[model samples]
Target: MGRLRHPGRYRDERRPERACRGRADRLLALLSGLAPYVDARFSLLCHSYGSVVCAHAAPLLAQTGVQVSDIVNLASPGLDVSTVGELGTSARVWVAQAASDRIGWVPNVRVFGVGHGRDPLDPAFGARAVDVDDAQGHDGYLVAGTSSVRRLTAIAVGTGDAHSVLAAR
Candidate 1:
């Protein structure tokens, strides 16, 4: 799954999960249609609230036979799941957040049943940490000259391994 045009801003405040869940549903239909063309499971690279959309969609993709190889969550506020096990996929889960990114300050709790959930960066959360020390801020992962982009690119193309990708604290 490549980057999707999210259309507008991130999650909706009125009913966040419903919105992301709806997107996930739509994502399933899209992937279902593309399933015939996919020779192997594909990977996903998501950032910010987009990660929320992915978190909702990941497991459902498997039911539709659109297996995912990997999931890279970048500077996310939350993934709506407390554990990688909850994602229900064999795909490797990776997390990346810059040392200076303010997203680290977001409370790792859900509110009104629709807020951010577990901190994907938390070692206990079980996502493979990706080094982004070269990243300056939340959106800096893809910025030029950052080690984040280099590693992300490799992961996208299937070259980087968990052992080679830099680890974040």
Candidate 2:
């Protein structure tokens, strides 16, 4: 349920390919040792650029016999979702976005020859959409006592009422 580290050239200068490769490499190491040390019902909770890493890593991990229970992307840019082809079919995917999110609002067209635009809100993306009230920017997904927090906690524990998950938060 923790975030994965992805190494790259520079935090602000990385190409998508570099990011994906770093994530794929790191996840391979994690999947290789999973059987003896991790839970069978593991899930992925990704945010911002981390979601892109998870997207790249999921299929590779599946090929190694690691099963994911869920893959939640809080504020992700589009990935090669189509190219990867059903990477999270075995996992319950929850994609949440705030209407006011500043970064997400950036038009999901190609940018600087690197496309960082995948609107999980788009019907074609195939993720269950959740709304996060007042989640207006990059760092708001982890806001204490918010819908994002509730959804993330639910995925972490494996079972919870999604219907009312974010009510108290």
TM-scores for every candidate against the unseen true structure: 0.86, 0.76
TM-score of 2: 0.76
Q: After superposition, how far is residue 53 of candidate 1 from its true place, in Å?
A: 0.7
Report the lDDT tens digits of candidate 1 across residue range 1-169. 4554342445565777777787777777877888888777677888887888888888777776777788899988889999999987788888898889988888989877856798998888989989887888777889876677999988877888867795936
Measured by TM-score, the strongest candidate is 1
Candidate 2, residue 134: how far the Cα is off, in Å: 4.2
CA shift of 45, model 2, Å: 0.8
Inter-residue clash pairs, candidate 2: 78-118
Deviation from native of the Cα of residue 86 in model 2, angstroms:
4.2
